[model samples]
Target: MTVSENDTRSPLLTVRDLAVDFRTTDGIVHAVEGVDIEVYPGETVAIVGESGSGKSTTAMAVIGLLAKGGTVANGSISFDGRELVGLSENELRKVRGNQIGMVPQDPMSNLNPVAKIGTQIAETLLAHGQATRHNVNEKVVETLTAAGLPDAERRAKQYPHEFSGGMRQRALIAIGLACRPRLLIADEPTSALDVTVQRTILDQIATMTQEIGTSVLLITHDLGLAAERAARVVVMHRGRVVEQGPAQQILNDPQHPYTQALVKAAPSVAAARLQPQVFATERGVADGSDGSGGSDGFAGSDGSGGSATAKPIDNIVEIEGLTKVYPKRGSKEDFYAVKDVSLSIPRGETVAIVGESGSGKTTTARMLLKVIEPTAGVMRFDGQDVAHLKGKELRSFRQKVQPIFQDPYSSLNPMFTIERIIAEPLEFYKRGNSAQRRAKVRELMESVALPNSMLHRYPSELSGGQRQRVAIARALALDPELIVCDEPVSALDVLVQDQILTLLSDLQRERGLSYLFISHDLAVVRLISDYVCVMKDGELVEAASSEEIFTNPRDPYTRRLLASIPGNELKIAS
Candidate 1:
């Protein structure tokens, strides 16, 4: 395809008929095939697709960071009128951080854990000959501030572990844009960040790139984010470019089946959970299930019936002035992680606690799950004071309430097979014998939509979504009445996230379970939660029904959070 007359200028980066393959024990795997994309000077082009769809592979190949045994079998990659396919390691190294900066997906893994932030940033500048030892410190602080880190001097002295997730990501952005590269490739840059933090990080990138006239190649699975951030969109599926066009045009009226499915599956696009008709007609409901009444079995929050109702629900768990504080090292002062926050979870309904990192959402969840004792508060579960529970009483409380951690990869025992992982709970509770435990494991797997064939596989072999399913199955093994889910779907792609939400909703209806769903994605919160609690800096800013909070938010923070949702400006085609 030839460039249009309007965009006739030579592109800063171009990939024509790019094909990438990886040699494995079984055979060669085609990771990318006949993929073509272009990013003109100062333009932002996004590659959107599901996991394993070759989006990241294309980016990695472009920057010559392909894994071992991976090769560019065919096609061309041109950067600034320079061919990169056959470049040697030394040649590619010079082009990598100097000419083409890259902000990887996971900040924790990308940033050197032992190094100070300032040293890492200075190393990038020094390696590229952008600064001298005398001025490296100054340059590091400047870059850190440019990446939106406040108090760069103090922050630079800390390591990656000392910073929050958003801050760590900002540090990486600083490293990526330190030398003012001509092109930047951000691979799922803010996938795990809160919506508000995500907006700020992306905005920082946009401002810096635009100021320097640097082009961007954004690879993400979020269609909404792609539409809002990039001027042009390239949809990839199974290593092929299925469609490419203007961002708004593709989002509002997607041409390909895969693109349409992505738009429909994105919860951020629909705004509300019960309003399936808004984006349903385009390609059915987001879950790809029948749109019958309460298809997921959960009623709307507006009292219609099914999973939710307008009527006041019975309070299954209630807390008064919940507070958690950690002692400061070598000081009398304490760090207040959660301060005087109070909320309630209604029986058979979902109450979501929404906030950014260190905003007390997760702290509150940990307190509820009995993982941590509250500094000062009163918690009543099923009308029983849980703060004083001990011995058998505490054990009884634990069996009635369960927890599904955020990272499925880290939460499950990697060495254990799927069968043992799920059945461990049954064995611990002594609910059944070996035969009965195996049978119960199968039932749990089926409930979460996993096949019995995967029972023997370890967590390492499962996809992110599948691992989360295993976590859910384990959580339900004991038939807990209330479940605490901390950032459950934040790491999943839109399709897998949709499926998990649907499964949670169905399970809630079938078993009348109450959920304390903690998350930063308001879109996901709106989809699954009947009630919403907005938290900030260890305090509850706003609490109301999901509809009221989204439609008529009273708090400024709530309004800002809603506004920051990606693709909020675009109107989805009905």
Candidate 2:
């Protein structure tokens, strides 16, 4: 798969001096500028960058699917000996999905909601002239099966809402490959999926593309993943090509500062385990403090927390035999979203719950946050039974325990300014007068490292990281003792993710904040957690210190998850 210069297989797709522009209310914003890339026959190329770095813009221009107000400013996109810039919509339709297929980022938005999954695939195949009405259903089943979806026939009959995240992504892949195009553009294909499901999707893409001799152009923010999947890695920053080279070369010896920072910030599963002892909690009790503060020196972007060890460990939140069950629509037995789960968060240390999408991690977090009522078992917060709290007591518990959700874009209300958003929590709690609340909001913003300049700006204007900071600031506005962070950094770029992790570590050290960090990423868990809890199928498979979980995982499911971390294969081979 090493595409040598001398190995002159003609480029399947080529872009020369490509530039894309969007017509904003103010003026024309140059989104992509002077970008050049090529994918040779059967070669896989990855364009990697942070959000708004023009990676997605470049791909959109190539496929003639630019959003409204966007147009190709200047570019020569020659695909298989033909120029695609000036093609009419009808003409482009003849070319699209027939010769150039695309698997868009979010299957939820990309896939039609009202239609059956089978009919959606049928539309693609019929539009591309890949199938006649007589054989389209058979083709649909074949395509879904090839994309790694189980019970393809039955799944085809279901609606998208009925499908799981991974299953929906597979359906997109099935549609993308239905026509067997000469080239496929997978845009952030598995960014929101679980690590194991991410691997399965990527593997399916590789297998299907290789079977059809189709080249690939992958677009992602994950450089480590690019290194593992693509033969060549193209690094883009600020609408320009910053670096381009072999995949391993980029990971092992990156030249550009941006690229180097990405590699440094990316948490590798093969990296050393971080050992954390307790930080001093508010109660002033010291648990066995052997001062075992072993660290890997993976100081996230802002470089915070070196060896923060602390005093006695107190259980800020505890759950014993917690379970949530619902009656199935047509089945005899109930469905357990979370079952027989017992976990505890130390007063001043992070306890991370790591699992796949349906592993009940988020469900556990919701129960702790009191978002939903648990069906079975006991839940306690700071020695008080959570299940028994009512009215004023429940309100008091909610004031002490806040939640930071997964998608900041959706978690934050677009109508509210940063100032108002942060002040709302204080206002609801009737903490102080208007003057005091405003001052507290500003202090909370500073704690999360957001500038005061952003106070009046709405969530629509700020970036993903900034909005997350706003969310964090609001969570801290309550001055809560325990914060349940649910996949906070999963949507961010590596550098932003690094900075957020560091900020969390800093806050925990300075304020003794106990975090119930729920994430599917083991790497992030290792970087920020003292204790790690592994979950599978609504059950706690393993619980131990972060070091012990990473170094000597006892559960087979835990081992499989560690193995599924992207780029683990490269580390193993090396």
Candidate 3:
């Protein structure tokens, strides 16, 4: 994936003075205003911003995917000299998925759950007349294989539920690239994937586009990813273009205030956790506590200065020889999701488990939460074995340990308001009367940095970050000593991720909270964790203090995981 000198060629896609609006009950909401962008042939350009910044809305308008009540009030979208703003539905049909292919953010929502993977790809091919009825199957297989899925035939027969998150994303990529369109719009294509899978999927996209001389308009909130993959970067904020320049320049020496805030907030660019001085200096400036700058509260010192050499305190949770095995449907042998995992978390400290998908991280977390019974081994919580606790003891244990899930959208209930969601735990525990519960809910909301006025709103009205904050607030309603945060910030954009990480750090400092953090993002692990545990193939490959793991990793797998972070290979401007 090399950057091409496509400036000599005419632009493949151009948007000039674009403005979009949506009619709502309140009034007309302007989503995009006077936004300008261009993508040259065979070049990759990225549009990056926080959620509701209008980047995704602009892309949707260009691809004719605006939802009902949304309209392109004013703008000129031209692809290959064809104006797209005023095109009819039939005319746009011929252009969409044929001339301009789109890979949406969420695979499960976009994909047909009832259809086979191959059939879906085949439908896309047949709809665009890219393949004849006879060779459609062959084309589907070829496309899947090209997108890096192994044993394409077997995978094609499986439904979406049978596929892992990474595999499902690959199928979507295959569908997007099946026709080899002249331009591709990938909207946060790998936001839900692990780092390793994200690298592979991105590499596949770059290779395919470079081979076909196709232009790419990448939409993401990850600045490191934008710097690593794109030739040019466009920064959007509040429905306006704030900055546009070469990717490295914008990352290294961003002139715009918002762009500078984004660079400072990106954890991937921060120093490793082991070096206290370096970490303090870099993080202090980013967080605006160094006395040298004052900006959005996106970055702040985590105060983990002496955690590397700090002595272990009292044990909050301890696991020994923990294992989980499931019977194979058609075989006598068992499948082990977790095997002989041993680790301990100290009181008021965070221990992070980092690994790729299907590597037993989530399984280990589930076992700790007692969501599933471990097939073998013992789990001790504050000095008592909890593996077989029942009745009152189990209920007591539940109050001490809570969980924050990965997908905020699915974890929350649509029928419930924010107030009800937070108050349910209090009601379940019979903690207090109606007035007391309401007061507690408002306190929880304040602790999570959300306004109490939103108490009556449902989850659908909030953004991804806000929804996740609500989830956190609900988890904290029980005042749990140890929270099992499973990929809590992976789906968020860089700025929102920074805010959440900072919020967690602040809470830990103030409340003396302990966390069993499980995530695939090493950079984030470095920011908030005191100890690090690396897992592979359901086994603990390495376990050490956070400093030792980041600075002196002994295991090959650990080193590989560190090296796979995005933008690590590139020479980012200082």
Report lDDT per candidate: 0.86, 0.85, 0.85
Candidate 1: Cα lDDT at 116: 100
State each candidate's clash count. Answer: 6, 4, 2
Question: How does model 3 fare in lDDT?
Answer: 0.85
Q: Cα lDDT for residue 180, model 1?
A: 97
Where does candidate 1 have its weakest 10-residue lDDT segment? 279-288
Per-model TM-score, in order, reads 0.91, 0.92, 0.89
Residue 25 error for model 3, in Å? 2.6
Candidate 3 has what TM-score?
0.89
In candidate 2, stretches whose alpha carbon ends up further than 4 angstroms from where it belongs are: 272-312, 571-574
Mind giving the per-residue lDDT tens digits that candidate 3 earns over 318-394? Answer: 78888999999999999999999888776777889999988899999999999999999989999999998999999
Instruction: Supply the global lDDT for candidate 1.
Output: 0.86
lDDT of 1 by residue, 38-144 (tens): 88888899999999999999999999999998999999999999999999999999998999999999999999999999999999999999999999999898999
RMSD of 2: 5.4
Candidate 1 residue spans exceeding 4 A from truth: 1-5, 274-312
Q: List runs of model 3 lying over 4 Å from the truth.
A: 1-6, 272-312, 432-438, 570-574
